[model samples]
Structure formats: C-alpha cells, structure tokens
Target: MSGVVFLILLLLGLPLAFTLIASGMVYFAQNPELPTAVAVQRMVAASQSFPLLAVPFFILAGHVMNCSGITKRLIHVSNLLVAWISGGLAHVTIVLSALMGGVSGSAIADAAMQARILGEPMQASGLSKGFSAATITVSALITACIPPSIGLILYGYMGNVSIGKLFLAGLIPGLLLTLVLMLVVYLQARKKGFAPTQANPPSFKQILEAINQSKWALLFPVLLIVTIRFGIFTPSEAGAFAVLYACVVGRFAYRELTLSDITTSLSESVSDIGMIMLIILASGVVGYAIAYEQLPVSLTLAVTQVTEQPQLILLMALAILLVVGVVMEGTITVLLLTPILVPLMQSVGVDPVHFGILMLIMVTLGGTTPPVGIAMYAVCNILRCSTTDYVKAAVPLFIAVLALVVVLALYPPLVLFIPELLF
Candidate 1:
C-alpha cells in the first residue's frame, strides 16, 4: 500500500525528494512502533559518507576548469582538428564533445554549454536551429561516459562498486559512441547538404600549433588516469588534485582566471553540491525503506524466475532501466536503482563494473530521448527548437547510439578489455 502510494505521488509530479519523504512518512505512520526520527537519522547518515566527498570536489574542479579558459582552448583545438571534415562544423561538435568530456563530466552542462557556443554560429552559417541543437545535444552523451563522471561516482558510492574500474571501463565505449555519432552526423549532413564551412584542411603546422595551445587541458585526463592506476592517489584524492591542477592551469598557464572567476566557480559549485547532496540525502531514507521491504531479493527472485539465461536477463533489465530513465533524472535513477540492481547482476554473474558502465550509459541516453529528457529540454529550450523538430533531427543519432549499446551489450569485452589491460 505504501509503495503504491509512493508510485502514485511520483507519477503525479511530486519532486523525488518529497515523494521519498512522503512515502517513508506513510510507512512510519502505518507502523507506529517505528520512530519518525529514523528518517532524519538515515538522511543525515547518508550525507556523512567519506566517499561522497569526491562529488563536490570533482564538481568544483569541473567548474574551475570551465571558467579558467580550458574549455575555450579545447574548442579551438577540436575545431582545428575536425573543421576541415566534410561536415566540418557537425564533426567539430562531436569531437569537441569528446574533448570536453574530460573536463565537464555532466552531460546537461556539456550540451547547454555547447549549444550556446555553437548554436548561433551554426545558425549564422546557414545551419538550421534543429540541426545545431540535435548535434550538440547528442554529442553531450560523450561526457556521461568519461572518467570522473558524476553519474559514475554516485553509482560507485551507492553500490559499493569500484569507481576507478568504472572509469576505466567507460573509456572504450565512450570513444565508440563518439565514432558512431560522428558517422551519423556525416551521413545526415551530406543528406541535408551541409558542407564544410572551412575553405581548406588545416596544415600540419596549424594542428601542431593548436595542440600546443591546448596541451595543458588535454593532459588533465591522462594525469588523472596515471595517478589512479599507479596508486599515487585514490579517486577522492585525485579529485582534490584536479581542483589544484585547475587552479594552477587557470592562474599560471592560461592567465585567464581571476579572483572573480574563483568566486563565481565556488558559488556555482555550492549550488550544484547542494542539489546533488540533497537528492542523495533524501534518497537515503527511500533506499532504506526499499531495502527494509526486501525489494532486491524480491526483484532477483522474480527476474530469475522469468529467465535463467544471463544475457536475456541483462537485456530485460536494460529495457526496464531505459524506460524508467526516460522519465526520471539520470542521477536520481542511478542512485535509487543501482542499489536495487547491482546485487541482482552479481547473482546473474555479470561483472559489477561492466554493469555499472552499461547502466550509466543507458540512463544518460534516456535524458536525451523523447517525452521527458532533461538534456533534451536543456538543448531545445536554448535553441528554441520545438521538441518535434529536435526529435526529427535526433532520431538517426538515437539509432546510432542504440546500435552502439547493443554491440556493447553483446560483446562484454568491449567494456572489460581496457580495464583489464590498464588496471
């Protein structure tokens, strides 16, 4: 009865935090022997986690890097490398997304930022707003798969999975998505008569010059991977290093960061931290209620009964996650569902690291999809493209992403190979 009420509240558009609290309150009301204070206690305990410290620190690092002019340099380098391709600007959008993924791990942030930077120019250059919006929005999917992804961090912290392994596993799949999306962009651009705006391919010297300017920004991810793999730092410690690195690069290397930039970055980080932590803290009570009801056990039993084959089970689970993700925010779905699903995956012999990567990809993809995609909203709102127009332009890219997901699902080695070789 309580669970039914909770679902109804969520369906009726109550905020997730409030829905969680309301549901738990009802449970408490039904069982008068249980103190209402337990909900407060659980929420506090959830925020007190040591591992969760990494969230804010990494978020701060991301903001600082963006403000420090690293992002602009990256865009320059990306344009130099791909601006001569057939669908020059479209390809640039995809490549820049891959580059920015290292610095901005949030997909919505990446999409929104890219839209503002590229949308007007693309429009001025005879590109439709729908085309500009679709490319930027879909490419932001790359950010969701990069290392230090907030989604991966939340999954690890909640599911007791290895953050480093999840980070490593995402590398190949993320790159694959980039390639696939680029191909789709090329085909779509050709079909639509979009051509290279650049007069000629950049010279080797030009490419080298661009690389030299952006080398500091490019090195950030390599440093992070090396530190984590060599045991010089844990994931959390590396986040602190990232903050310091961003500051040094901003102030000394780029000479673009100012006191005002620092203050603004800090303020933005505080707001981001507040929203994420609030969701985490509130979801703790909900997680407890779900566990108290043996949701995982019941779910495992039910799934096993339906299918004994691990691959079939995984497909079914992915399908369910895709549907739920279409409606729920990616981070919230990851936090609330990972705990319920990880143990079930373990029972079916799926590697938790691999499962986490797939889960994150699927959920993030949902945010770009139709009906209720948050990232979709962000990009379309900024471009003033109707949802119908965005969908028409995005459908091919969506199919491309789905194909990539299917390939990764069928061949686990695509995910596991890099992690095994590196870690």
Candidate 2:
C-alpha cells in the first residue's frame, strides 16, 4: 500500500515532497484502473487554488519585513514591554513570538530568526545556550496558531474550512500561550536566579517610543483581520495586501528597505514559496488517493465501531497525530492527513475549527521536539547547543505546551469562541 511505502521511504530519510510524490506514483502504478496521469493532474491542480495564493503572498510579506528592519524594531518593543521580568529575555522571547507570528507565519523561520537574534543575549544574561535554544524553538509554537499561519491556511484549504475563521480562532489561543509560557519562564527564572534585564518596566516615554517605532509591524494582523472581516479583501487578496503593505512599510515608514532588499526578499520568497507550494502540489496527489480510497469514510466506521463517544474518538486521533508529528514535518502532516482526519472529527460532532487549532498545535509542536524536530535542530545548530541539553531544557516547556493542548481539547469553546463571535 502507498502508506506502507511512504513510511519506509520516510524512515529512510527521503525528502517529504519526494516521498509524497513517490507514494502517489506507487498508488497509481498498482491501480491499473486509474490512469497514472490522474496523479500528475492532481499535483498540477493542487497549487492552482486562489485561496492558496495566500501562502506565497504571506510568505513574501514575511520575507520583505524580515529584510526591512521590522524584526529588530519589534524585538526592541518586546524588550521594552517584558524584559524587566525575571527571566526577562526568555519572557521577551515568548512575547516577541506572539507579535512576530502575525508577520512571519512560519514557525521554523521565527525559531531560526530568534535563535540567531536572542540566543546570544540570553547566554550573555546567564541563560544556558541550551535553554536559549530551547526557548526560541518552543516559543515558535505560538507562531503556529496566529493569523497568517501557513499551517492554518493549509488546514483551511485541505479541510474546506474558512481560513478567516481559523485566523480568528487562533488569536485567543496564541495569547493564552504567551501568558502560560511567560508564567513558566517566570517561575523557573526566579528559582534559577535568572535576573531581570531592567530595574522596572519602561518609562511611558520609552514605551511610546518603542511602539511608535514598531507600530507598522504591530498593526499588520489588525489590518489583515479588518480587511477580511469587512470583505475589503478576500484571504487571497489580504495576502496580496500583506505583500504591498510590507513593501510600503519597508520603503516609506521604516526607510530601511533598499532596492537590494527588495531583490533579496523576492529571491528568498521564490525559494520559500517554491518549496512550500511544491510540497503542497505533491500532497495533492496523496490527498486525491486518500479520497479515492474512501479513507475518511472507512475511518469513520472503524472509529464508530470501536467507540461512538465523540471525545474519546477525538482523543485517539489527537494521540495518533501527536505521535506522527514527532516523525513528520507539520505542514506535510496537515496536507497528508487533514482530508482523512477532518471528516472523522466531523462525524463525531467535534468542531473542525476547534480540532484545527489543536491539530496544528500538536503537529507544529513536534517540530520543536525529538530527533526529527526541524525547529529544534535549527535552534540547537544556531546556538551550538547539544541535542541532549536542548531536550533537558525543553522538558518543562514541552509539558506546558502539552498541558495547554489538553485544555484546548477539553474545552472547544476556547478555540471556537472567537470564530463564533466573528462569523
């Protein structure tokens, strides 16, 4: 079966895109009744979506802002806001992630960026290299829930859910995470003697100056939501607006973006978009095969026969996803499994948007964990920390993330309240 081959190739360390393509090809090859051309057609059709255009546009906007000095300004604002706390840099890291999530949308990108930006400062302030690396990688989890999140976009696309709803759905959870992680850092930092960076919270003048400087970066998510809510822009159009907004902010407001920066952002976005879009295209073939197999229907009957309780069935699926996330990248997991899982949950009366947040969290959480955690490795490599130390440092944060996940899972309203109110 394609699933079996896909796992073997994955264990053999095949690239995710190629592994998807290969498994799809194997599926077509064996099923002589279905022409091989269908797989190719599926891949081609997958990336042709209009809602899907949000991925590239948002990606380019993120890259543009990255080069335009927006990141540094936001970091300054984060410091002004939170660096007086115990484990101040750690708190700042968490808060900055909440802020940056709106801008970057990519956890791996935010993690790598923070590990590079904050790792040294954390170390200089007496945080261990491993702790610094772990903080950045784990905090990137916050980014996975925030608006413009590529994972959410992909889930919305694959699951036939509203991307706008998904965006609003994430706002509260993302903020909740910011508070929870900061509390964890506060307690640990107190016991560990990780002192505050400042004597007190910033003066009003300082706060105003920081916000004034970074206001453009901060206003982006607000602008995105308003436009989408009022029908001023579709999600796809919102993405286009995101790109144009970033360009304006970079060139005029910040006066930091040069022609060279524009060229660099374009080059970076081309690479980033090509990589994500290709994987998406390859996933289309696998998704088509799953649909052709009636996998969701089969899962529904199988799960129903085992237990009809909605919560228990949902738990089982979440458990499977949590486990698989450790082995697979998040977006690939979303693309490959959303079709199969969304229907299963719908049958059980679990709200897909609720599950979407929980699912994205679990899947993205894996990227911050284990042997295959790309975000973990990225941060560790940047900070030159050993995998062993990173794991040890991550235990408490991992527990915090998992705990929040349980809360989100048990209380659907926590995830759904915003979407319900907005839409």
Cα-based RMSD of the predictions, in order? 1.6, 1.3
Q: Compared with the true structure, what per-residue lDDT tens digits does model 2 show for residues 105-189?
A: 4688888888888899899988887778888889898988988888899999999999889999999999999898888888878
| lDDT string, candidate 1, 69-128, tens digits | 888898888888777666777777888877765344467877888888888877776667
List TM-scores for all candidates, in order. 0.96, 0.97
Segments of candidate 2 deviating more than 4 angstroms = 102-105
Instruction: Tell me the spans in candidate 1 whose CA falls farther than 4 Å from its real position.
Output: 1-14, 102-105
Top-TM-score structure, candidate number: 2
Q: Candidate 2: minimum summed lDDT over ten consecutive residues — where?
A: 100-109
lDDT of each: 0.85, 0.88
Candidate 2: lDDT over CA atoms? 0.88
